[model samples]
Target: MIPGYPKETFFVPDGIYLLSHSVGCLPVSTEKHLSDSFFRPWANSGGHAWTNWLDNINAFTQALAQLFNSNAQNFCPQVNLSSALTKILFSLPTPTHRNKVVFSARDFPSIGTVLQKYCKTLELEPVMIPQDRNLADPQTWSDFLDEEVSIALITHVVSNTGQKLPIRDIVQLCRDRTITSIVDIAQSAGIIPVDLSHWQADFVIGSCVKWLCGGPGAGYLWVSDNNIHECQPDDIGWFSHKDPMSLTMNNFEYAPDARRFTGGTPSVIPFTLATESIKLMHSAGIEHIHSHNKKLLSRLASQLNVNSPCQPNERGGTFVVSFSNNQKALQTLTSAGVHCDLRSEGLRLSPHLYNSASDIDTLAELINPLLGKRR
Candidate 1:
């Protein structure tokens, strides 16, 4: 751990805030960054603003690339995960004969909705594979990738069920079948260390607002060097062009890197906050954050297993846990100031590095009364 940088403390209110999986709480440092950046005269002033703004954007992109284990040439900043994915998906070149994209049904609605909209307009097929609830069985994905798959879009960790899919295996499978693979790293980016070189994904998209604790609008998209040529730039912007000063009227030429994925002027202030957040993560070391987050969830699971209204899945350690309680018990948790959400079968709680054992104790005490007879 770096000296002089104290571990951040989060104000999660009296109620349980287990919804870090949905949207993370802002780091107190990020609030300070935002406040400081907002008061800068150059940010709100009319002159020389573009220079300051663009410089900040460049720095943020470099920081994000370092976090993702890629070169700055391989990354682009975006408003959010959905916006980044939309630009990348729409940019894939349409083959004269082949026009299909393969993905799992477990993907978030953001990816599903946009793909559906594009399929209707382009007359292409959006192939969704069967999502088996049992993630332990690797054959589930193996069997899905057995057919004629063009593009494989997958989530690193499922939000609804807290299942960690076999991303590397799936990416390799796609490679064998000449398919493009896109990875959604929203739930796993900062929580777990990622190496795109080993994962070998064609494209990856994620948001800093969740596990990274960088506040809203801090998101990114990464394009692999090989597949960078496979996607077209549908949503063009001057920022994406190779020469911003060139007054070529009739031609639109994009940079030969991930900058081709960026659309317009991104929110610069958010980028500064994001860079600071990444620096904090780097200082603590990603492996340390991973261990810390897992420890918090493991403790929470232990508390629930001993006295809560559900059984604990001990192996699931992605900073997210779900308590198997009825609708009434779910409401009780919420009414008590636990800020969690209900998924299909349970109430979800995802604690980040800022969460402490006392937080777990507080949650356990409130939820103990809701348990039933356990065999």
Candidate 2:
């Protein structure tokens, strides 16, 4: 592997932390920005500090826009992907014929939970595509779409198995069937190229707490150029009004772009915290980080005992390694200061740019003896 990034760049855990798919390691600059940009302003300026916070909000949106090769106007901040998806679900008209929302049962449970409410209240159908298909192939989804499907919620990278659905093809198919495609980019946001504006999918949700290293409380929603103008989400607050400052009790209008999706007062601290992490990501280009992490996963896989694991290119930031006694195995890794999480498939390992080959090799050495045998 290339000379890896400095560990000093992050406030890493005591052991080898491999849980970027869950919550990313803290970046060193987080402290400085939180103080200088957020705490400092509020402490010094009292109630009038909102002007500075608003600027941070704009900056945060702009920073995220750079990742997807879009502008600030294309994105809006939300509390989380669930809320972002909820706004969209409430916004879209309940179709007369095409009322099914297609998604995989194995996708994130929270998303399914959100969709289920729509199914109950809005008379939408839940079309859970069978999980029996080849775990690594997007072609399995080719037949899942039809005119009856109104919205397709696709997980860009499956949380458990690190499998990536062919989003581009899926979006294209949605277009053919006239279905709205809403993508969840939680596990792949910073590590992989989402390029939401390029794909022109109906909507996408990304969080700053995971791979983006921005911590929690900052969620992103990106509306495609094709759907931005006409999108009128039912979730409304005066902040998202076409003109927030100009208010009319009789007449209310939503913002022209992604801003229409955002409602209510936001926690402004996330913007300040995320700025530093985004800067670090830009400094270490995402493509380069992806290439390095992929090679590391392939290297780790070469040291594992498994059958036909998805290739590096086929997956995103996580790789699940199975064990007969995963609990004991987890305890062992934790004891050795190697951090990972257990999921449906196996124990998940997610490395970031800050993780080096030596770290993976060390983790593998700790993990090898725990394989197959429960004791």
**Candidate 1 lDDT for residue 76:** 86
TM-score of each: 0.88, 0.95
Model 2, position 371, has a per-residue lDDT of 76
Off by over 4 Å in 2: 1-5, 307-309, 372-375
lDDT of each: 0.70, 0.82
lDDT of candidate 1 over 3-81, digit per residue (tens) = 3433345545555566667666665676776555544637577566657667777878788777777788888888888
Best by TM-score: 2
- Residue 69 of model 2 has an lDDT of 82
Worst 10 residues of 1 by lDDT: 307-316
Candidate 2 lDDT, 1-375, residue by residue in tens: 334458788898887889999999898878988898888889999877898998889889988888878888989988899988888778876678877888888789999999988888987789897777653465666677777888888888989888877788878878887889998999888888767656778889889898889999889888887778667788778788888878578668888888887677777887778877887786677898888888888888888776224666677888888888878788888888888888878889998888888988987788777875744
